[model samples]
Target: MTLGLPDHLVEPILSRALARASHWFALTCLAGALLSALSLGLTYEAGLLWMAVLSVLAMAALLVTLSLRPTVVLTIAYLLVGTGGTYLYTTDLLGLPDVFPASNMFLAALPKLALIMVGGAGSGALTGVLWSTAGFVLAETVTVIAAAEAEVTYLPDGFTISACLFLVAVLLLAGTARRPHRAAQSAIHRAVHADQSRLLRQDLDLRALDLNQDTTLNELIALSRARAGPLTENLSGSIRAALHRLRGTDWLTDADAHRVSHSPGADAWLTSEVYLAIERCRDRGLVVDVIGDRSALGRLDPVVDRELGLAVQQCLINVILHAGIVSAEVDIGGDGGIFSVMVMDAGRGFTESETGADRLGLRQAVRRRIKRLGGSVTVLTRPDAGTSVLLSVPAAAPAAAPDGQGTR
Candidate 1:
């Protein structure tokens, strides 16, 4: 069971949620600052005034940190340092009197304000909630001690209401941060089911059509042309092979039939197997423009290189044969442990639904080959839109013996 929101729908929902949380944090910081200023105005005492000034400075620091969009490490560091600085200023290095009029009131709100400013910093909801909980505990404990020594209660001045609101706001922000990941999982489930449905549709519509045109019908035509005599052993074997091909999904696994080769130009540099694959496509009169980091392909293992080459060759062939264009481009790059190559063609494209059973080049040659190499293939195309085939393989080639032999 899953929500079937389209990708465009899901993305905007998550983005707006994040934007809302950011704005919420900023609004909370401004509110806390105003409240702290109000507390200072009510007391008009010198010691308490200095503490309020320090609290305002701390809030400014927090607002600056937020504007910079600090990473998790920096966010945690700022929160700790800001809270520690506030603690130091409140006690005046453990030398100040607790009876300084607004001391408890000023200290109580500062820590919670700092936490509210950064409650949305990390990557997940649970982490933010934990940080908020820790901050609340520390703030409450410090405020209680200061208020008890001053012979006043901390809960009477709207502190309890403010604390509850802060906690609730932090929870809401965390929930917003978490919703997108859950929605993304649901999106993946929907996509897998959609692919399954497309595969079934292709099987139903084109399975018999392919078998009839290329196998059964051809065999019958051959039989009609033959003299009235016993079938030759070779003809009998051919018919049997065609029958076997029609009965099974061999069309999706037969790579040899889809293999392409090219003659390398005398002036060309054979930097990698992908280069070799490009040469093969060029030999077939397809115009291919190469770009990006062409060097990464040279670092692949022999087996990985061959598989990647075959997949690239298949993509180029499709662009030449069916893309309604004579030219294509191959862009290569590496990210972390994955090496990626994108073969793009600005030509008339077709949807996934058009991948009939007879169109086995993409399924068997491009996708299955990359999968065998522990890689993935993604196709983006639609009617009148250009096609881009993103092929990604492991950056670090599999370990082998020193003499270029498999260790196993």
Candidate 2:
């Protein structure tokens, strides 16, 4: 049986109980005396009647001291009054037989003894109960046996049987006191440990949250955007500059430069696939030299198939970001599981040192994308010269490759 009182929060209650020990004793004594008075009236015992009277008088004495001294003094008064009251009840008043004559029944006043030991909730009462009950039973049994032999007090066997049940009450009180306190303490320990476990779980969740932020998915994406943006811009500008130079040199006629080299159907396909590429490059000032099969790329369903569209998109992004350009050129060719998208340029090229962020936009964003679609991308470049991206992918083709040319 748990006490059901809060253990950690009970200190103040305990201290107050201790502080008012004398009052508690005095009040309990008064209550016991009234009970004894009733017992005396019922049993017609003059001794018990005086015990009741003396107990009531002791209460008056304790009350008198309350006005004359501090509360602690009142407590001391209660203990004094209680002890005196017990003796008076036993000897001068109640004439109650000493159940434990070799021991002291005064020692068995539970609340009084408990207060003296640990301020009214400790081992004193239990000890007193155990000692007194044991001694009473053994001594009374022996005394009654001897009395029967001597023809002393008239206690029939039936009366003796009923009287001995008092031992049961004493045992009950002792057992009750001991069990609940230990149970309460055990409950408190379990509660504290449960709270600690909950705190540990909360700490782990916080650590996981911390781990997920700042250095995870969002951080990587931000870094990718930063690095990829400028590379795309610079490549476009270089291509446009090369275009003006090529036109001024008269190296290619308008027919040579502007002619669509593929079948009109292929030309439409190429336009569809490469339109975003052209727009992206032009926005950043790159010049595109549309060469070879210009109409071939759009033959596949860029509008219907998302993966194909995204692959085409990344190819253009890569041309702008990774291919250092003099003139951006696309050589679209091949058929059925074999297609090539060559983006030719003039500048410094890829190297082993360009890894991670420096290359994720090109490698992760573009090359890997086309490769996933069962296509391949090759980087052909050298320093101060040129670069070309060869993308060979599987697609059903209509005709052969073309050598188309356009300057933009």
Candidate 3:
């Protein structure tokens, strides 16, 4: 579900956008192509073949995304190739050094940024940082060249100034154009995926609406505030993440939370509020099999209890709606002072968004919860490959005390 070329072109442009209209690759590609066609006299047979080849390849890549499955991998591969092709094409006309490197910059920058936003930091920081710097440097060089050209004596100063200014203006325009024109945020008529997201949101709203409303916001907040003390049990990260999201969107201020509520017993506090969360999911017909203990032994850690609950619920909702999944499995357990929750579904797993920005439903919901709790999530999903989500949180107390610290 997509709009038209007018809108579709914005996908990559929006990817590398900066604060004050910064990304220049898209503009460079545009101006380069136009100038090349005009200056080359459009007469070289070999050049004509290159043009045809480029057009065919680009179209074929995009076509596969529309007419096939596995859009994530295809999109990533196509974008890399297309970026490289744009650099090569621009180089053929403008002769830039290391065009592939420049294209690789575009290929890396946006997706990497987006990946971080949605919990892909599982890849580690150093690699992500190096790649980001390389992309930005290459992108900047390609863009700045237009404004840095030498003055031409044959051309009038005004004309040269005007031409340079025009070039700057175009780069600026292209630079500004690279904002988040996310597929998740597009005109309904043109959006290839709006309905899918809309459905997922609807499910969440419906569920939230059905919850108990008589509970006080302060009570919920107190429930979320992590206890500071020498404790024997603790909540995990996923539960804490869910709590933060629950407060941010649902609670607003404590006043907003007054109506909705959750009260964790001792068992839930020790095992992870995730245990009870799975029960809620099962009540909604979302669980294929629930395997976990719901009883515990201590005060519930505020952060983990709330977030892990919400994350679990969101995961279930995502599968029910998008995974093409009929059944799922849930496991909540602890190992080495770490409370973990694993959800597996026979549905197709997470697909990297075609444009990079997380979609409105699954990614945003999960990430908001995960990040707020100082936790993380991972998705190993492919078209028809099934989906698996593993969430872990620090436990309240270790089964075996460290050396010389057996007594707390």
**Candidate with better TM-score, 2 vs 3:** 3
lDDT-based ranking:
1, 2, 3
| TM-score of model 1 vs. true structure | 0.37
Q: Candidate 3: list runs displaced more than 4 Å.
A: 1-276, 292-300, 353-358, 397-408
True-structure RMSD, every candidate: 17.8, 33.6, 20.8
Best by lDDT: 1
Segments of candidate 2 deviating more than 4 angstroms: 1-267, 303-326, 397-408
Question: In candidate 3, what residue range of length 10 has the lowest lDDT sum?
Answer: 114-123
How many pairs of residues collide in each model? 1, 14, 26
Model 3 lDDT per residue over 104-171, tens place: 22322232222112111112223223333443334334323421331111111232233223433443
Error of 1 at 255 (Å): 36
lDDT of 1: 0.63
Question: How do the predictions measure up, each by TM-score?
Answer: 0.37, 0.30, 0.30
Ranking by TM-score: 1, 3, 2
Model 1 scores worst on lDDT over the 10 consecutive residues at 259-268
